[model samples]
Target chain A: MTQVVALSGGIGGAKLALGLQHILPPGELTVAVNTGDDFEHLGLSISPDIDTVLYTLAGLANPELSWGRAGDSWNFMAEIERLGGENWYRLGDKDLALHIERTRRLNAGEKLTGITADFARHFGVLGRVVPMSNDLVRTMVITDEGTLDFQHYFVERRCEPVVKGFAYAGAADARLPAQLQEDLQDPSLQAIVICPSNPWLSIAPILEIPAWREALLEVTAPVIAVSPLVNGQAVKGPITKIMSELQLELSSASIARFYEGIIDGFVIDKSEAHVAPEIAVATHVTGTPMKTPVDKQRLAREVLEFARSFGKL
Target chain B: MTQVVALSGGIGGAKLALGLQHILPPGELTVAVNTGDDFEHLGLSISPDIDTVLYTLAGLANPELSWGRAGDSWNFMAEIERLGGENWYRLGDKDLALHIERTRRLNAGEKLTGITADFARHFGVLGRVVPMSNDLVRTMVITDEGTLDFQHYFVERRCEPVVKGFAYAGAADARLPAQLQEDLQDPSLQAIVICPSNPWLSIAPILEIPAWREALLEVTAPVIAVSPLVNGQAVKGPITKIMSELQLELSSASIARFYEGIIDGFVIDKSEAHVAPEIAVATHVTGTPMKTPVDKQRLAREVLEFARSFGKL
Candidate 1:
């Protein structure tokens, strides 16, 4: 089986990652998740993207919320509010266990990668899930409201602030986890898939690591990116809003251009297939909206087959 | 109205504290809870005794469990067990809010006394509740199984270890909280009630503070202790087993003798009133088993009236 590494962010990326996990053979998929959104809340280390990927792959994600655990209880949050603690970021009772355990392990001098892998195994996830780096790389949103932490801007403020730019604080000191390096350098590596998550908020943090971009440029495997934009709007979250705020055109062509130099192929929604000619890379049009498990697997299969067309499989 | 102070531990102490809260006028009772059993668990600062007192006084305590909040959910604990995290402490989802909020405040440089008082106020507790000291005063049980922390000895091990002796790890440096000092020195102070918690496990931690004993001896207010034992057996917990292991007679007289010169009066169960001759202080016999809210109030009235009989009121 050819090994594939997927770069993922949160909900949108987790949907595609889950799809990839279903189609690939056991242990064939490695998801390098963005930890830029990780932050300490109430003394607990919370890795939002990593948790979303884990929950999605393990089939424990809440169907309605698109995050958190299924049948989750809100007893903890209710009591926190009563105690006058900050409750803008909703934490489910079951989901809180992950944050508490992760924080405990981290405080005890355990590496984030090892703790994530242990959690993945315990959750019975078939594919490997690893953080992009062990060191802190906080994603700071330089908004009109001032510099805000990723979760503060996204969850607490509800993405209300106008975007100026993003700064990955501590990225200069960050190094790619050894597992991700091994996956990237594997002899049986097929293609690197950038899942349909926000390019600037999700994928950019992983690519911002100096060594990561260099490694991707050096690898023989074709680098493929799936468009988060489906016509001119994001399937979910604030990609379209951010693009408009940054004065960038909300089109698949723009997304493909964002990954211009490194990407060899791009996947976009079939409705916007006419823009394929404008993209310099080889483009494949497919149904990209992942509303169900079948939709996820279908899109995943199409993306993989598109990567294979480059003759690198 | 006579102002009074109570020294408390966990469940057993909490029951009597709840009774006192119900009987006394608002702001007339101040509980100085032992912090020796407090420990960091899952990266949260958990003050078990303080929480129990708060919950009981606020009428939010679980009637059956005698600890934690009523109608609590166990989703946190269940998920923690699934993740292979420590599950011995059994933190309920609702109860966890207190620990999380308390830890957050403490980490942000807020004093534990202020946080606890705020929490009590939030919970609508009428009487004031304060920790014995702001400093860490961990209770260490030196048993045949070696030195174990208080919670480890009680909750994790189920009090199975053979007792040898006990030590307060940080008692030498601990001082009475300023609020407690003020309450003790108040001109309107009538009596100090020692709740019917284990002398070895609960009350000992608070009393072990050198300043606490010295302050009690210097105060003019009568000091009254309620016996935890009834018919040579503790109503709850391992008080009897610990007493026998420590080579002491399992009798109410032993508990009264344990307090010796510090207590001016002692309250015992009507069945054990015959042992009054062995105790030098004034003894009052009452129905001390509190199984209902009415029973708590009745015991509270009895204990207060007993204190009044010393002519200090």
Candidate 2:
């Protein structure tokens, strides 16, 4: 009966969201998606992270990619290619429609948080979906090569560039959505699960918002973070690589250290269970290899069960 | 070689532009395209008339549709559909690249005319293509149902709406591109030919620019208009249907009467040779059905030959 808030980014986070969606009652779960990776492409405002979470929750996500609509066509992108535009991003025709509608609504003066809420409601999604911020904030990776936009670093350039650090460009000006702020104050807000998303990239931006960290400090619920990195490697994406590039120890201990004072518990992959005793905070180990929907749900349920034990705290 | 300017909209006008391009020496022809049909769709500023003329001139127009790029693909549009976006306008993937790039550049502060000129130049088009006005102007249809945007009437609804009147919403404030105004004043500018495009919907918008009629009147060169309606029928599109809906006669005589003193010569299709004599204007009969590249060139040659006969008039 506890209302759970899951902070998420794109793929890795979406897996956890799908898992949470499976165990939690529809209205009891709220997934707050990162918008720092959102940018305008072909005049359409595209929220990569928000879309990934939406698609995964809607059961329309590509099974292999864990993003975009399954069975999506690329006719629109083919037309774009013929016109000599950027063909690198690979916008599926169906996916382009969402971007178009999102852009249309956004340009018409609708806040992105409201638009995402409406989109989630329209897609028959039972759980609440919220954007991290309504303001325009872009995640930029400060690499040895140069400062690059998140999509450029993640999608276009394939994260090959060495990350020196990352900056959430507009986080200083962003404010937590009113509902998100209110939910943090709710007595029923029993848990805040930071999905095993990339530390510096995904969770960092959410925490970077000027009031976001302060608001999380205000919540009475235990703040738990799941480690995206385990056994000296990332379960997915550039988390471990970025961690190493930033000269941090690439281990569950390092992830805990990264979130040190802010979190009450750290969830690591069962593969890294040996290192659990070394973590400075309370630690829980689970089978976090989310390769399947079943894997995602199992990991999510295990995390929830672990958090419930902390009700004694 | 006498320099000539032709005012045009989509298919029918592209045909005359093709004809004029073939006969005129390099730089002798300037095709001023209608921009009133332009509107922002999915955040991209789409100029239908400008693109149609550009594609037709670039030798990349789809032969079947007589608009968009030749051999165009639809991967992008397919993707859009998969995402549950509007699939009404089939923006070919290849063709979409141009719109996307143009929209990007436009948003970056490039003028519509400059962006179009760059596209034309890059495509190796020799004839100068100028937008009738640099300003944003949209044509709206006041129908029995309601006032609808041009694309809504033309594409989405497939021209099924009953129109009461048409309004060029921004024409009263639109200024003719300075280059075009200077062209009108050039002594070497020998003739002005209005291509056989839809009079009420296409040509009327260009003419509606408050200073346009005066500019046309001040020009010493002969102003000629080609009849889109031949033997009481249009070569393509809703010209006849729309004309009839607005309670106007669908005939070459009506077209001639429509241009009365504004034109010195009226080019009628050979099929409507009988009606040419009724109007008190210099009229010529010619082959105007431009179906192929050769047809476009040949028509351009004939129109030029007819205009050359009145040189220095």
Interface RMSD of each: 0.6, 3.9
Best by TM-score: 1
Task: Provide the TM-score for each candidate, comma-separated.
Answer: 0.98, 0.89
Worst 10 residues of 2 chain B by lDDT: B75-84
TM-score for chain A in each prediction: 0.98, 0.96
Top candidate when judged by lDDT against the true structure: 1
Model 1 segments beyond 4 Å from truth? none
TM-score of chain B of 1: 0.97
Per-residue lDDT tens digits for candidate 1, residues B1-313, read 3388999988888888888888788999999998998999888899988999999888898888857999999999999999998888989999999999888889889999999999999999999999999989999999999999999999999999999999998888889888999999898888899999988788888888888988899888889999988878888899989998999987899999899989999999988878879988899988888888898888888888888888864
Error of 1 at B119 (Å): 0.4
RMSD of 1: 1.3
Q: Please report, in order, the local distance difference test score of every candidate based on alpha carbons.
A: 0.90, 0.82
Model 2 lDDT per residue over B139-193, tens place: 9998888999999998999899898899899899999997788788878887899
